[model samples]
Target: MKEHHLKLNVLENSQAFLIEAVSKAIVAENDARNWQFAILNLVQSLELSLKSILAKKHPLFLYENIDNPKHTVSVTKAIERLENPMIGGVKFSEKEKKGMSSAIKLRNDITHHEFDFSVEYAKAQFLRVFGLIVHMFRHHFDIQITDYIDSNFIESLLEIEKSRVVLIEHANTRMQEEGVDSSLVWECSNCLCDSFVADKSKETCYVCGYQTSVEECGKCEDYFYSHDLRSIEHLFETDFCEGQTIVHNSFGYEPISICSDCYVAVQRDIDEQWQQRIEEDEYYHWSVE
Candidate 1:
């Protein structure tokens, strides 16, 4: 058997490293909701550390002679003020504070009590906050050992695949209502050329007997394959479907087409429903543990 010891510190280094290590575990183990929290804890720890250091630098911070307490005087602003007491005038904006406060609340639940981790909420939080860390890293405020992966990569991949599932459920619903023929058509959207599902051969199209030379769509005045609605990710929509993981990992490259403008609308409805599940809050169950 093998064992490893881990620790969190508030005395000197702060608990940021502990949270970060847990985050890596969450991501690797496919525990998204938990991963979301690990990232948040790490960020909050950073903010707290910065504020503490700044408070030490500018001991008179709370008495900066401002008549009103600004909604924007959040942790980051306090940290900066310590570095340059002259700019104690600037503070964290309300938008930044709201995001941070939400993060704090979420982290508290995961850390102090048992909370059901919502992957979407976690993904949303990361997309909102990682912008700051990226900036700090780029400006040399933070040291880099190697290329660190961020949550956006994870969220984007997740969304692309989740969106595909939404599209497929919608197609099945349509098929049940009107049958397959109407639900499935592969004509070139640009030239209205009949699309054939066959091996890509150098030979001319058998339908119109059009060679590779005459491949242009007469309707759109472009090559039938030029507009190439292949841009539409149909992996989930057809038997030609690639596996979910493949499509998920590809991000936008695997975008699915909803066919008509109507189908797009239809798909949108289904997607919203699915998204609601991921984002739905259960505040009633306040027990963190």
Candidate 2:
């Protein structure tokens, strides 16, 4: 067998994958299967873009085992490494992270298992990943995304991106015209848009057709999306640890979730009480003096 040396042309490979991804995306409007492949290519392109950035920092940082140099790190590892302050120091918003994670899951479903996605839903997820590609190209790599893809393809992507805006705007107008309660609407966990209706009987997202169960808030007793609730933790005095010289023995009680609004109100009350205590303490100190 003839021996061959492996060479990693990360940036060039990223450009090529981007080109392929957009080409597939242009044709993907009519073909669902094409959309699946486009998603795969787009995720690969993004992974390579991240690797290219890390490689610029240090080639070894991209590898799982720096000494062996046989296998590279996974996309998840690459993202974590990018955020490391000592390394790339790249930051991503929670929404961006959610998008990347959803894309990776979609890619995995396409590659490793049976999957089904409507054209609109697939495009929505695809756009989320594509947004990251654009971000990495401009912010991290310092390159124009259009440089790799043709102008026509860029226009196609622009059109595709417009679908979400139109869908969201229309949904908003419909809700307003119908006189839907603002408290019943929420930002979707999937599409990250304010198009989810958390009705007591039905919880549905108009933008992405995402559905989940809703819960009643402990304070307001109003129904909200599951993600909108914040888990509440309380410290309780433990009977077992009583009389122990331990520094304020306390145990975390069972967690209970409260709606965002109620949590904010609770926090505000705590802040007011804390301020009052501080003022009283200061007055007492001044009186003693």
Candidate 3:
């Protein structure tokens, strides 16, 4: 088999293990032990998936010396290297990066110290981890793991969802006690849960801790936000802003209405045109006369 195919098979096996771990964690009576093992397996799955992607690109990335067993890239190192690295047409989001970092930290804590673990926390982490896995499989490998989930597992997932709702309610109560506007809740993009308390002033989501300024897309007139596309003003300042405009909102501030998709399309088109021009030019001039 090709190296990429072998790496993909490894990723698939890791995902299968992750699914089993999650199912046991949710359905089993022992919360502490089950969650402990679940989290360990979760971290393992993430490591294997990341390493597989890196290995597909080049086996050297997974090992410092291909011949030596001792020399290998750590999980932390793999994550750091994958920062902003595009794989299979999908780029890792800042929220996903933060989630991975948080998972790693939690895993380390669980391994070293005797920390209090709750079903709610485990469920939340499961959602985040599972979401990442689904994204990678669907987008990166063009595979679907949904078929792997049996009916019993699906029922357990529903129970977990109910638990998550209760947790969100508790979170809202805590936010209210802390003088935060708990009424301003929004759906979290990361967990796809309606538990994200949006702080418009800070542009932060309290639930997932994601920070992004929401704006209406001028073309679609739909409100959208992106953690990655922060400095979009440069695009408007360039020739790409032929028909795009920044309009003053009711809040007395001008916000651009460029959605992430539109922004990407514009940038991609510009890059392709630039590359074509370079290819056509016999002698490209660097200095302006």
Candidate 4:
């Protein structure tokens, strides 16, 4: 049988890390210094929880090099091992993997080097990592994560999550009820959520209250956030590589922002041109024959 006491110890340590993370996170809202440590503790909590899950299979799996067995595995390696068919066979979605990878990188940056993070972005990342641990506790261990942490601290975290969902839902509801055009709704540059409303007079994010003016795509003449447009420019250079001087072309074709539609249209035109050239070459060969 698996070492039941060892599993319990790992889980308790994981909860301790989470509790410490929560205390830091609460202070981090106003105190910038605490954000770094909060994130570190949060990642530590996630790492220990992952290790506990892996420990169920074998204790040696916790080590970075199982053959030598000196140090514990990093979060990334633990995740990779968990997904192995012979080891754990736990399936993680692409989105989950991306979030976890980002959290791990953030943890490494905070631990090894000086770093700065905006509070809003930090909170979003903390929640993402915490959600992963919650999933493991609830699904794998059949225990609610909220039951392990301080009720007051967890309430604040849950409130943040609830508010985020409500903001998106409110924006979507407005879109549907007001008969707003779907094209007018875009991803918010601030929160990276699909809650930005680009009305004619004003453009604003429903979630984060980030406001910016809307601009038309040069080629398509469709409205889009200024940041969303891709600027296309022509350049002239004598030597293409190896430290060559390059200048913007002054052939009266000013740099302009192109939307995705215009980009796709240009690609389609090029494809059609290539097809026409191929057909002409085939016809010439037939005539010569």
Tens digits of lDDT, candidate 1, 95-151: 556566666666677678877644444544554454444443344335442345455
| Candidate 4 structure quality by residue, lDDT tens digits, 92-127 | 998789778888888888888887766656777888
**C-alpha lDDT score of every prediction, in listed order:** 0.43, 0.78, 0.65, 0.79
Q: In model 2, which runs have C-alpha deviations exceeding 4 angstroms?
A: 1-8, 189-192, 208-289
Model 2 RMSD in angstroms: 9.8
TM-score of each: 0.33, 0.69, 0.55, 0.65
- Could you tell me which residue pairs clash in candidate 3? none
Clashing pairs in 4: none
Task: Quote the positional error of residue 68 for candidate 4 in Å.
Answer: 1.5
Say which prediction, candidate 1 or candidate 2, comes out ahead on lDDT: 2
How close to the true structure is residue 102 of candidate 3, measured as C-alpha lDDT?
Answer: 71
**Deviating ranges (above 4 Å) for candidate 1:** 1-33, 52-93, 137-289
> lDDT for model 2, on a 0 to 1 scale?
0.78
Instruction: Quote the lDDT for 20 in model 4.
Output: 93
TM-score of 1: 0.33
Highest-scoring model, lDDT: 4
In model 4, the Cα lDDT at residue 208 comes to: 72
Cα-based lDDT at residue 140, candidate 1: 32
